[model samples]
Target: MSNLSKLESQSIFLLREAYRTFRRIGMPWSMGKDSNVLLWLAQKAFCGRIPFPVLHIDTTYEFPEMLEFRAWAQKHYGLQLIVKINEEAIARGVGYETHDPVTVTHELKTVALQQALAEYQWDALITGIRRDEDPTRAKERYFSPRSSEGEWNYKDQPPEFWNQFALPPKGAGGHVRVQPLLDWTEYDVWLYIRREKIPIPPLYFARNGKRFRSIGCRPITHPVPSTASTVDEIIAELYSTRTPERAGRAQDHHERNAMQKLRAKGFL
Candidate 1:
């Protein structure tokens, strides 16, 4: 099999493993390329049916285009999309306009996610986090278990030798976070999208002489100056771009270990 085929097989295996092990499971859909790809892989793995609901933490600051595309994808794929909003934070004006990105992310994204998890008891959460995305994420395992408080202990991860993952103990309230595409890179994601003929949001293509290299909330996400208007062109651009994918994300720029700190505090 080709390398991409191998990656696809491993991802599917991880997805199946998570499904088999966890009773109540869910995946986060941020309306980004990674999550979109993950949703596609779910359909592929389950033969056109996604078993669990796709959770979307709406900070209310997302770009309008993102919400539009999200609705479109949900209908197209028959997805059970659960939108979790931080009403308290939004009511209190806790976003980039009034507060810092770190504070806003913690209040709007992290806190909202924790509350959602509490509302619905989940045995595992399947996320689309890739190891190549960042140095901190690079330390993640294919099936990393978190504490009851939803905290990740990077130093004490389970052993996964020969593709065998250690299952979390039964009746454990804290669900494990399963990463199916931990080995895939940014370029690989684009290549898979092209290969699968997946429909991506139009924001990825250049419009009006600008395009967003990485997508996030409107206020925190700034597009890089790019003229690539097609998927093939974007793939070529990735070959030459050396900057981090999250570089344009304002929260990542606010502090050196911002992502690490957030993940440590159960953000993701």
Candidate 2:
């Protein structure tokens, strides 16, 4: 099999495993390239039907195009989509200007997700986090468990070499996170998107000469200068550029361990 096929096979295997191991399994769909790719993979794994619910934590600040695309995909696939919003944070004026970017991240994303997970009682959350995306995410596993309160214990993790994984024992009181895309890189994601012809938000394509390298809330995300207008051009740009995949995301730079802090507290 080709490299892409191998990756697809592994992701499909994990998706199936996650469904079998957890009573309540859900996937976090960010409507970004990576997560969307995972969504396509999930469909393939379940024979064109996703077996678990898909959660989208709408901070109410995502790009407008992202919301449009979310609605489109939901209808396209007949998805069991759960739209989550942090109404309390927005009502309290938790934003980039009123609060520190990190604080906003915690309130709008981390805390909101904690509340949703606790109430939903999903035993496993399948997210689209990639190891190469950020330093904090680099410490993740293909199947990592979190505390009942949704706190991540990154310092202590099980080894996942040779395809072996350690799912937290049943009734151990916490849910495991299934990261099928942990091993994929930005280049890999683009290649997979191109190969599979997946639908994605248009913000990634250059408008004039800028495009979003990473997508998040509109308040904290920025577009990088790029001339890439098509998927092939984006793939070529990824091959030639030295910039980090999330270079335009402001939250990563405002605090030294922003992503780590947010992820530890259950931010997507």
Candidate 3:
């Protein structure tokens, strides 16, 4: 098998494993390339129908294009989407424009996700986080467990030897984060999207010589200089680009350990 084929198979297998292992499972879709690929893989794994609901934690500050794409993709893929928002935080005037990045991210994202978990009580949540995306994410296991309070103790993770995985115990009052795309890279994600002909948000492509490599809230995410207007051009650009994938994320620049702090508090 080719490299893409191998990666596809392994990811499909992991998706199946997650379904078999967890009593209740949901996927978090970010409307980004990696999550789009993950959604496609889940469809392929389950014969074109996802067995569980898909959750999207809205911060009320996302780009308008992202929200439009979300609606389109949900209809196109027949997704059972559950949209959650931190109404209390929004009511209290918590926003990226007014509050600090760390505080706003925690309140809008982490707290919103926590509220969803508390209401849904899912056994597992399948996320599209890859190890190569960030330093803190590199330490994640395939079946990483969160505390009852939805905290991640990165230093105290269980071991995963060979292809074996360690699942969180039943009735732990917490959820296991199933990372099916942990081993895939940024380039690999683009390649898979091209191969699968998956649809992604158009914001990723360059417009007026700028494109968002990673997307978040509008106030916290910025675009980088690029001329890659198509997926083919994007793949070619990756071959020689030296820039980090998330260089445009303004929040990452706000603090040295901003992501680590947020991830520990259950930010996805």
Candidate 4:
């Protein structure tokens, strides 16, 4: 089998395992390229129908294109989308400008996600985080466990050699964080997107020699210099590019430990 095919097979396996093992399972959709591919795979896993609710945590700071694509995709795929807004935090102006992006991320993303999970009572959250996207995310496992209150212990993870995952012990009440795309890389995602014909937001394409390699809130994310306007071109660019995927992300530059701090606090 080809490498992308193997990656798809493993992701499908992880998605099924998470659903069968946990009573209530959920998947968070960031509406980015990787997460969108994850959503497509989830539907394919269930025979063209996804069984779990898809999550979209709207901080009201997302790029307009992201919100538009999300809305369209939800209807196009007939997704069971559950949206949660951090209205209070946004209202208080806790954005990339008014405060540390880390603080903004915590208040708007981490805290809001915990509240929604508590209300929904979901035991596991399927995330589309690939290790190659960020150095901090490289520590994640296929079946990483979090505290009952949504705290992630990234520092102490279980051994998972040979596809064996050590699940959390009983009485360690908490939600399980499942990462099906943990092994896929940035180029793998683009390849899969091209193969599957999955629709992604147009912001990823370059416009006048600038394109967003990693998309986030418009204000917090800057586009890199790129002439790659199509998926094929983007793939070719990545083949020789030495730049990190998240280089355009402002938060990563603001602090070295920014992504890890967000993950430890449950920012998916």
Best by lDDT: 3
The residue-by-residue lDDT of candidate 2 on 156-235, one tens digit each, is 88887787877765345578889999889898999999999999999999998899999988987888899999999999
- The per-residue C-alpha lDDT of model 3 at residue 106 equals 92
lDDT of 4: 0.88
Off by over 4 Å in 1: 170-172
TM-scores for all candidates: the values are: 0.96, 0.97, 0.98, 0.96
lDDT (tens digit, per residue) of candidate 3 on 4-64: 8988888898889889988888888888888899999999999999889999889988899
Question: What TM-score does model 1 achieve against the real structure?
Answer: 0.96
What lDDT score goes with residue 168 in model 1? 56
CA displacement after TM-score superposition, residue 117 of candidate 3 (Å): 0.4
lDDT pick, better of 2 and 4: 4
How far out, in Å, is residue 252 in model 1?
0.7
- Kindly list the per-residue Cα lDDT of model 4 for residues 162-245, writing each as its tens digit: 988667652355888889999999999999999999999999999998999988777788999999999999999999999889
Worst 10 residues of 3 by lDDT: 163-172
Misplaced by over 4 Å in model 3 are none
Computed on alpha carbons, the lDDT of every model, listed in order, comes to: 0.87, 0.87, 0.90, 0.88
Task: Give each prediction's root-mean-square deviation over alpha carbons.
Answer: 1.4, 1.2, 1.0, 1.3
In terms of TM-score, how similar is model 3 to the real structure? 0.98
Residue 127 miss distance in model 4 (angstroms): 0.2
Off by over 4 Å in 4: 170-173
RMSD of 3: 1.0
